[model samples]
Target: MTIAMPVLRPKSPHFSSGPCAKRPGWSPKKLNTSVLGRSHRSKEGKARLKLAIDLTREVLQVPADYLIGIVPASDTGAVEMAMWSMLGERGVDILAWESFGEGWANDALKQLKLDDVRVIDAPYGRLPKLKQVDGVARDVIFTWNGTTSGVRVPNADFIAADRQGVVICDATSAAFAQALDWPKLDVVTYSWQKVLGGEAAHGMLILSPRAVKRLETYKPSWPLPKIFRLTSGGKLIAGIFQGETINTPSMLAVEDYIDALEWAKGIGGLPALMKRADGNLRVLNRWVTATPWVEFLAVDKKTRSNTSVCLTISDQAVVALGAEGQAAFAKAMVARLEKEGVAFDIGHYRDAPPGLRIWCGATVQSRDLKALTPWLDWAFALTRAEFCKVAA
Candidate 1:
């Protein structure tokens, strides 16, 4: 069963989930270079940073009162800052359905050592019981989109409107590509490297009034690192939210982010960004619907992520080969596609179930995904044939 190699290939084959594909028609020459080689504390430098924040607020349509800050260490840093700064005051409900969510739960239970932490979790391709989350009294932590698992919460309806405690959402993979319910989330974190595909090392942290109030009033029992500190003199540091970062940021990365933000605004803001992502997903969806040998990892269609679209081999022969064999087969297919230069970095996350994880974020063009699917089929058919021959 030899299948011909795909003749037409994706023009740009970068499908990695993080540091995703750049916005259409992006170029280094297009970035504003004046911000580079100047002190981040300089008036001009601060203004550029402020512009990024302002554009984020404008494009994301975040509520007027919620505070958006640029933080260090990408989305992980932003999440850590929120967890370390404000979780001691009340019991916490941490939900896990994927690697990143599990990491947060481990930090709360193991590192933070919170005595009253409850972990509600589900396996890969599924979501935890959102009904068990007590946002009314206990703080809740969850990832709105599980990048590794390719599962996402359908909506924020489960969160109570009158929640007394805060809800922290790690939305690194959701922002721009998906609509975020700002009122339901008290703390939201994302990185430049995700949906908009800007350079890495910087994170965006959005705090609700409730989260700011917690920061101002509640002090954690553990010692706070200088980088993690978000308060001073029992008052929220307003400068942090206004673009004065906690630490020195990469000015070049800042410019790249601003460039992406500008590109986002030029293309009709949030709605257009989400529509692009939806279009990319539809490309994959139609292929998956027609192709019988592959299936989406996300069990439920409603929970499937349009950003990090994960897939698994569904042929009974491949499934019967056991986990290790499936992993090898999938890896071979990924390698084939990469070698052919039709796709790259489509392999599943290391800890996730062995499969393929193709990034279908807003930055990725739908045409590229359409071209890549035929390559996917070619790679799979050829790899399966090799495996069968080896078995024979």
Candidate 2:
């Protein structure tokens, strides 16, 4: 059956995973107030940077003892910094379920070369047995949300409050969209470009007092790059948390982040942001439940991600395409949607199984998602018809 083209369309069809859709009323003029053309070390530049940090803390409701710093590279750099600075002192445990989580595991095994390391990984669609980690004494590193696979840790219940080691989380896709169990996480990293839809390249690193202590005391066996360095001599660098960035920062990006933070505050704060993301998932959930051709990549509904909502094409026709043909079908469907200008960057991550990955972050309006769902159905129907005819 041919599905007719839907005339109603999403007001904004900018759903790329990383550099996601900007806020509802975002404009270039938002950065006009940016303190540009000044040394980041200058008072004004530092003020902007500090404002970004403070606003992040306020919006996220981070613990008073937790420190937030603007790191050089995106979330990766912040995670690596924590791993390098603290892992060798204790045995390590790495948990992975998707591409980014697996990347961190590889870093621990290959790059850092930590000997006392244990890796527990699950297939893309499922989460690892988090219960196995309840009382482990090793430093633990994992992603709060598996952006590529659309799986997320359901909660922080698996982490013991009195554990000896630290928990480092790459929460780039989860920070604003989901609440963090601050008491359970020792180090948390994210980028502005994710949930808040700000610029890329700048990473936010949040550390509990324990993590800061680890940095101030433990020195890595490997050489520390200037950008990764978080401490000076033997003392924690107080300036990094105070907006003295390790290297020059794009003041423009900082300003944009501040604007996004202000927007988050305006619309109620963390709870409202989480509600928006959850509302997006609710919209997609309704579509997916009604659409027999598509299903969530995440096996468990409880662990399914609300932000990076990934879906697999499950129609018998597409499934018969086999892996290679399914990949091609997904690519074609994505291309069709882009050509129609109804969606962009809806393709799955390169490493994940062939499917669609839609960004349902806070910055994305629910009405856009509501409008986009029917288009997805329309595109999938047309693509399936074309592929079936070719096969026949």
Candidate 3:
């Protein structure tokens, strides 16, 4: 017999965006080992690093030629390193559909101090025309997914094969949850804390030969922080990109990340993982379409994110929490779900419209999402009634 989804509870939480919800039969205690205080440069750290990289490769089916490395900082570290270390010499065409991608473009224009920067920006729900942008003259920067706005680029087919500039992607929410056209991306950065449901504080930087070559040939005039510096004497530092860190790493967090990757592999790699995310999203799609009070933040179906499914309630009472009060209500509902062991951390991004942000990542099972929908409905109803009583 088929099963029905229940409203999510925190003890059995249904949604969490990052440093996200864990998989079945996994817990922090399961990550316990005596490596807490050990130097990440030691043999113990090396083993953890190798396992982490190996597992990432296994789950992602990363190319044999491509290198996977533990870089300093989270997704921001890896991306900023690529921007600061690789740009300035070349003209850049940056794509911004949402906040994080826009943040990168801002860095390129204002911080990198680049001579020529072309920016193609769009509203939160819509995507700018990628075709309108000239790809031949300038290098391109874009996000595979817009986590905060819940929009993502549909494909990399638009990126020309022989384009002179490199393609840099911040695929934090897209990786593991979607199929990546790696050949089109010269530099890709993502954090384990997203889809892997792993702990935060670390990010991974994956490079194509083109990106690596750029790093080797170009030298920016700015000072290279140990974390952002990827080379020495104009030669790529082989160690940093090969699971070697320029600074100390948290062995405990490294192991926890490994544990999540292993779980991802156990559930069948990316194909199966994508199916899970798609399935969970279908649940949200149903809820959003049938319920008048809620709808996707993205303008169209093609750009809507399957990973971070952000929404805004349509009803006045539904929105009355004011942006701040609504955000708090969203948090309160998440807490209420948590208190009842129904769901947890379904709050929206701070700057975005009021409503809930549900993580429909692969790590979250369909059964749990099936359970979560009802909880969201239940929580919204109760919260709205209470909110209305106060207004009256």
Candidate 4:
């Protein structure tokens, strides 16, 4: 008889959808008191802000011409700020495939109150037609990666070369973990929690020269909240764009982010980070392929995300159990895996179809994900026994 190897959960208990795992040895306690709830207007805050910007550029390889700044309310606030500041004047095209992108699309239509809005959406794990987007000559709001659906836009080359409108990309899950086609992206925003394994509630906003020009030239009709305001009198508040947040930020979180950035730099920077995520996905890829009961949720090979790998069990498997039985079986499978510590938080997002969404972020080691498959099989067998008992 063979004994199964013991599973090792990371020294941390975080595979959270947001507020992802921190770099191996990061600590908030090490931050200087100057970073601890200092007035955003204070000189101390500016220094911390400068470090974040500098290291973000070093690790992420953001262009020198671009501006990186602290923004409130995580990725949501950052995207809304850009939408409120830059949309409306141009005919807007919103592309949504997954839950977060859907949230943004709803905000553009219902909250931003834009009449010229065109929404192009797809079901989970699929891309909205690129032709549909390129066909229209409008400013675009799209998520570079659909975290909830496990789908991603493979390339931005489909965007019209001489398009008149700006391309705004929400790259929260894609940044740091994947290579971005920055030249084609006019405005980009990412939060530290998803890929960098840092604290949440703050977001990074990157603006290309063209996006800065839009901020300086155009103003949306909506009232700007103190948190969302990006410009002063139709001109970019370049200081806020530098590091001065609109309001105070927890220095502890900033320090944690700084540590993540430094760790990223030491690990061969973006290229290495991307390699880690791809490696994890490859582990998942083998599991999805070898397990007959399972398959990838994303149909297109090119669009399958290396970051969030979602999976669905086949209808045959579902039919083997009744509705309640199916729900219980799925729950038991995830619970069993979590209890064993081989995997946690594999359950799909609430709005997503019933399945598993495993975050294959840089912090997740590939071997850990590979080990998860056997646990999944074990749990499924256990659940299958439950269904069979009723039949007996």
Off by over 4 Å in 2: 32-34, 390-392
Candidate 3 vs candidate 4: the lDDT winner is 3
Q: What C-alpha lDDT does candidate 4 achieve relative to the native structure?
A: 0.80
TM-scores of the candidates are 0.98, 0.98, 0.91, 0.92
Model 3 over residues 1-392: C-alpha lDDT tens digits? Answer: 22233534334565778877777688888895767887777787777788898888889988877777888789999899888888877788888877887899889877777888889999888888989766666788888998888988889887888877888889999999988997788888899889888878888998888888888887888887877888888898898766678788888888888888888888788998899989888988987888866788887898788899888776777575577777767777677677777767777777667677889898787777776677777766676666656421
Candidate 1: list runs displaced more than 4 Å. Answer: 390-392
* Error in Å for residue 115 of model 2: 0.6
- Model 2 compared with the native: what TM-score? 0.98
lDDT of 4 by residue, 1-392 (tens): 23344464444444555666666666666545555755756787778778988999889999999988889889888888888888987788889999888888898889888888888999986899987885237898899988888899999876766777788999999998878888888889989898888888998889988889888888777788888788887778878877777887877788888878888888899999999989888888887777877878898989998887888767475756665566666777788777866666777777777677788899876666665667776666666656556321
Model 1 scores a TM of 0.98
**What would the per-residue lDDT of candidate 2 be over residues 202-242, giving only the tens digit for each residue?**
89899999888888888888998888888888999999999
- Give the Å shift of residue 291 in candidate 2: 0.7
Looking at candidate 1, the ten consecutive residues that score lowest on lDDT are: 383-392
Selected candidate, larger TM-score, 3 vs 4:
4
Ranking of candidates on lDDT, top first: 1, 2, 3, 4
2 or 3, greater by TM-score: 2
For candidate 3, the per-residue lDDT at 173 reads 93
For each of the candidates, give the backbone clash count: 0, 0, 14, 1
lDDT of 1 by residue, 1-392 (tens): 34577788899999999889988898999989997899999999999999999999999999999999999999999999999999989899999999999999999989999999999999999998888888788899999999999999999987888998999999999999898988899999999999999988899999999999999999999999999999999999999998799899999999999999999999899999999999999999999999999999999999999999999899878888899999999999999888888888999999999899999998999999999998888888788778756331
